[model samples]
Target: MRRLAASLATAVLAAVGAVAVVGQPAAAHGAEVFPGSRQYLCWEDAQTATGQLDPANPACADALAESGPNAYYNWFGNLDSNGAGRTEGYIPDGTICSGGDRGPYDFSAFNAPRTDWPTTHLTAGATYEFQHNNWAEHPGRFDVYVTKEGFDPTEPLGWADLELVGSVTDPPDTGGPGGDNYYYWDVTLPADRTGRHVVFTHWVRSDSTENFYSCSDVVFDGGDGEVTGIGDDAGTAEPPAACPDEAPGAPGDVTAHDVRATQAHVMWGVSQSGCVTGYDVLDAATGDVLAATDGSPMVDLTGLDPGSTYEVTVRSRNDHTGAVSDPTAPASFTTTTTTTTADNAAAAGACTATRTGASACS
Candidate 1:
């Protein structure tokens, strides 16, 4: 395979660890030839051609030698090479005429009476990908046309024509002109439609010639299904121990601090067993668990009387095992209140009257 070339800036960027590049064209267009031999033959009528062979003609033997079993190419001669002087340089006129060669290549063998046509079975609502494996005759980019079995091959597989799909270039390993290039297209079947579907792929060359081939590897898979949960309810068997656990662990390092407006802030470090499920905030004063969910780290308490103290704590929960972790140490904080001089004097007077034990004038 020829190495695809890259731009200097691209090379420099890759060297600097910025980006990775792939599939660059190594040489200019048409710079390289097909890797192997080009000449091949397909017989029109093997029985008639065989009987017509003249035993006296040595050229006929060479042509016959080149035409192997099933009338495929016996040798890869320089048929398409530009250096070959004959028009359509690769296949020679002498070989074509001497061995009963027709003006165009014969593909009758691809159809029945010669060989069985390839069959493709597709499922409903599934996307199918298709490609061609051989690249000898059809080089350069091409379009694949599909149609119903009863219609002419030239007719397109229109909207009502069952499911006509195109594929990306066949990968080089699969025998595309470019090494192992795969042409692909996504096709989906109607929900209610099922049964046998016939698919055909043909390459339209630069000369507007159509070279047809049949394949059976196109496949279909049903569309996306319902969403699935990932925990105990998910029905899948428990994974190995190495997998993260859902249970919560012991809590630690509880701390409480003051905030404005009779509110206090609570913080704690949650310990996890295997995996941290989530955390919970609790009202320490009433032993009431306030918030319960995963990923919340802090909570605020409000509406308390000024100069009053309050306690807060937090606990963690695990998602996988459905376990709740131990609570963190309790912490406390006091809220502050504002007072004027008049209010202080009134408070002092009330305290003095209460201390004197006098039932003075009401």
Candidate 2:
């Protein structure tokens, strides 16, 4: 599961209101790999030797055009920084696949209604080995859901159309982080399930409020686990040059303010020569991207460890090139051990990470 998020880089945590967010994670994530999710399949469908967007499928081509190639490049990152295991009502109806359209990259275009999405052929009522990628390993639970019988593939998916099938808590994981390695498990498809349907996966991390969602288009048409609609037969030709020169340069004037028990605000100056789609907030100590935000110049980092000091850096992002700038000067802040209205999440009632770590209010 190269589970990258949509282009909505901001890690927004809107409950009944709104909280401004900018930037998101570049790496350190995961997604479904066995029954390939739309992003995964689209990435596979469009992955070129040149790292450019040239999909053979119509749906993948459209998604690449609308959401850009980074949607597939960082493919395993479609996660929300503030999900907290909340589903259905919290994630809305049609946008379930994109984690309510909140995460590091733009995956909203993948929610489009199309049946031609590269599909996996499987037989109904079969016990199959399931695999979820561990591109970035974290302790978590993987919930498996499948669409109900007589499901319509041409319409936007809604929660009502799905039924929880199985779940595994921190299942056995193999392979190293940042590789094809994955968490493996066994899933028995519902015998009643047939025809066109989707296998939805929700990966809820135990250590944080972050959650990764994957939507795999599949059919129980009496076939094995053969995938269709992707063309890599001819293989590598002279690859086209991707849009890398347009990658944004490093940002500067980085600063953090409004520090609190579980939150801090990061701001930076972007004077790059090219497009700067968003910023990635990173743990300066680990170099792992903590969260992603929109194109805004500032972002609020929530869910900090109280009384702990942290140093962070901001890296400018270019979604088109999937390139991130060098780290801006590190900015440091310490979380206040004391609780506050912001930390309490009085109105929003949801929070992301700060190190960024995950914390949620009751």
- Candidate 1 lDDT (Cα, whole model)? 0.31
| Model 2 segments more than 4 A misplaced | 1-28, 232-362
Q: Each prediction's TM-score against the native?
A: 0.25, 0.63
Query: Tens-digit lDDT track for model 2 on 1-362?
Result: 12222221111111001223211222236788778788877766664433334678888889988886557655776888888999988998889999998885689998887798889888888877788877556777999999999889999899999999999898887754434567888888899987899999999988678899999999999877778887653232444554556777677677876677766766566333555556777888898877665444555666677898988888877777688888887888888889765466422534443332633221
Q: For each candidate, what is the lDDT?
A: 0.31, 0.70
Candidate 1 TM-score versus the reference:
0.25
RMSD of each: 33.2, 10.2
lDDT of 1 by residue, 1-362 (tens): 11222111121111111111111111001111111001111111111211111112222233345442212221111112122122123323223211113222222222221111112334554544433323232334423333343433223223244334443342333322222233333434344443333343333223223222222212223323111121222233333342245455665566754333333444454352435545665666565654443332433333344566656677766555666666777776665675333222223321211112110000
Point to the candidate with the largest lDDT: 2
Assess the local accuracy of residue 20 in candidate 1 as a C-alpha lDDT between 0 and 100. Answer: 10
